[model samples]
Target chain A: MAIHPLRFFDVNCGIGPYYNPPPGHDPSVSALLRGMDELGIAESAVYHFQAQQYDYRVGNETLLRETAEHDRLHPALMVGPGHTGEAHSPDEVAALMRSGGARILKMFFGVQPFVPGPDPFLMAPLLDRVAERRPLLILDHADIHGVRFDWIVDILEGWPGVKVILVLPKLEYHERYFYALWERFDGFFLELAGDQTMGTLEAIVARFGPERVVYGSRYPYFTPLQTMLQVIYSEIDDEAKRKIAGGNVRSLMEDVIL
Target chain B: MNTDSGILRSALAGEPLDDVLVIDVHVHWGRWLTMNLPAAEDGIVRKMRRAGVSKACVNGILNPDVAEGNDQVASAAKRYPDEIIGFAALNPYQPRPMIDELRRCVEELGMRGLKVHQMVSAPAYSPFPIDPLDAAWTQVWEYLDARNMPVLWHGVVEEAVIARFSGIPFVMAHGLSSPATFRALARYPNFHIETASTQNTRWYMAEAVDVLGVDRVLWGTDAPLDDFAHRWGVILDSDLSEDEQRMALGGNAARLLAL
Candidate 1:
């Protein structure tokens, strides 16, 4: 499958390649490249669906290896400190980053974040490791699936260098939590597709400045067309649209590109 | 064993609740919140064992989320023989078809009654308002009264719900907006209150023994529910005696539904 050179980095797409094992959707470089072509996406950082509900390290490692096997795919190895028993110790995570298995780490907020024991600030070593290795860390933003804004601010204050990506925040969450984090953090970025109303993106751009937001549609359960429609039909300016539609993610990905 | 029979153990909260054959009356029997539905043996066994529940009325969510719960509840009851009873929920708007379906759950599947949730996911016009004794909602009351099965309706309105269900046996849910509804539902002989999901509406369940008589209340927990079922356990641990406790737990529900 030929690649779409226009898409910078795709986010929120399902790793349906693992479960549905398509005639063309096998977990190979060809399958990912094909996915990008079908969706007109440039490079997508997808999460293994199996890992979303289960283990993270092995699934993440295998995904990274599969991406390595493919010359075209740029993989974001997802991680959650709460789900995986081993990675709670940031030292173990630091080792993984040093070894290059850890790219951009994904954290789930509703289930894994806000669990009592682990302090959100304790991830300094882990985020620092990703930053030290120049890898960006993406955090889910919403009361439903990610960390609270207070935690996001804590992360930004603690690890300013690590590019913080907010993933798939719900509508209410975007309005209340996103604004607070934007006010506090200098480099916090919003991942779109979760916010699909006409002026939602433009409103955020107006408030937080354009550089702080990017576009990533949660696909499969949600479709590429639906996500694409939101960005295409949005009232945000073409420059801001282009930045979110592709450019912002591209800038963030440049830091983590292997 | 004498001590056990007379004094039931309870988690801290309310007075020692009723202690008849403690039935959940409301339980989710099928697996699968999204996409796929598992058999839910774990859910059934774990919930029953956790609260020391002897019987449960089950529901499913396959058909608009709660459709299959009826069958799952009944089958679970069959497996344990009187340990679980299924109560099928009927969408009131679809009242015509419900005649046959209600017959199946009660006559064929042996479900105890109908458990309809107005707040959770029931569609609009399902119940065709059994209006407050006016000539308008006569058809709705006729259809419900015809079935003669106890309708476990999850209702929430002040004097309105009680007025609408004047002659029917309705289980006011969540204490129906606290003590006010709890006090009102008591006026009707057929209406009862199930303290299942009411976590802490003090006006609703604190001194429920004094508010709603022991016989007017039932101990039902939304099973496989998080520890919220502890609300009933709190009732069990309440200061009430074993006999007074039995009526609230199962005796009252069993008699009301004729189980």
Candidate 2:
């Protein structure tokens, strides 16, 4: 096949699959990088399992070390409030970000002992702390096991700089949220991941200018071929299409590169 | 254009078109609604501008508007006529009102179609044959069949229900609960399915279209904050052909909506 220049560059892809148990070794940094190469993705803002589901310190540390080791991958450090069941001490959460390992501190509030929005649980306060630093907070906002979109938007609004990486937008509400983002916040981005709807991405690009969206393949979860094909053919202007495929994320990496 | 045949609209089969509009056939605004309530028109219009959605087919809602939500959808459709296609959110329980609104959708508001949910309309509306053979739905489909419009349905167990409604066109809402249903709809002309808001993986649905025809299935992204590229990416990423990709992107909906 003739080479397509856009396919050669993707800046920020999550490190997992479209399926729950994503494909990869337990925090295998190599598997993540290889997946990137195969998909023609030049780089990514990586999040580790330890960062997502398992214990925080070990997971965050593993992520830090792995990210430090990879050239093509960046990191989105996961955080937990101390009072929550999966609480990561503020100091620990700070260390991961302060150490300059993550650009956007990823938050999975649904798993918290404290209810998602408010309660004695530490989610609200912890988020306030992160907001202080003005870091983007990438949320796992799908109907998955139980992630709520309303709570996600509330948190995003609460913390002004918190740029939400609404992963799996195709699985979310295109009509509603597309309108909300442009009206509500100008900075946050709607990201596409897994092998979701890259075709819809093109459609969105045609309607909305291709600025607030990015290309995010939930890596390891989907093979490179699967993720790559999604962006291969688009209906938007070819230049804008490439941006949604990779450029938007490439620029976002200026921040995600943390 | 389908240069090989030159029978249908060049743009219809899988060719270039005049507009770059988008239509999301499957999506929902219900459940755990804790976020800031977006100003339906301004919010969606702004986002559409940002996400690149030219128009979206929004359907299904709850509580306050069980019977009236379709009106709100119609409002959005009217306000953003180019950007939104409001699907009537019918309550099988409130079948009379649901049908009333469905008629209004076609006659007054000019909506393209209807959307249903067993989980939402269930036992409350009337549940037995799941297929709209019930006095209410039979009439509803009968009316729809005469018009030849499509219905986007979500079932407690959607496939069997979809099978019962074979002659009428259907768009499966979720992939998880609707898998077996998709396999069945793969064959019929009056049915189409999308993987945007379904509870299953986009990869699986992409693979399913093959056993099913690529033309029979379409692509949609539940947007606002959801990724359009990601959903389309799955279809394009699949083994499906470019012609197939064109169909999924907007071709299928274009044809289905045309009728």
Candidate number of the best TM-score: 2
Q: Can you tell me the DockQ of model 2?
A: 0.13
Which ten residues in a row are the worst by lDDT in model 2 chain B?
B1-10
- The per-candidate TM-score of the B chain, in the order shown, comes to 0.72, 0.75
Q: Candidate 2, TM-score vs. the true structure?
A: 0.56
Candidate 2 — which residues are off by over 4 angstroms? A1-19, A22-43, A55-65, A76-109, A112-258, B1-112, B117-131, B146-148, B155-161, B176-191, B198-202, B221-239, B257-259
* Cα deviation of A64, candidate 2, in Å: 4.1
Best by lDDT: 2
Query: Please, what are the lDDT tens digits per residue for candidate 1 over residues B1-259?
Result: 1123242323211112234377666565554334121114444554355445566666653345344656666666787775666677655444345556666776788776666665433346344453333442344345556555566666422355445655556776545235666675566766677775443222233456567677777766554332223344335434456676677667777777676
Query: lDDT tens digits, residues A1-258, model 1?
Result: 222223545665556344432122244456556645654566677666545545566666666666665544555555655334744356666665556544666664455434322145566556655555556676653354435567767777776766777766553334567677777766677676532322345567777767887666554433343344345433456676677767877676666634
Candidate 1, which segments miss by more than 4 Å at Cα?
A: A1-8, A16-32, A82-85, A88-102, A112-118, A141-146, A256-258, B1-259
Question: Which one wins on DockQ?
Answer: 2
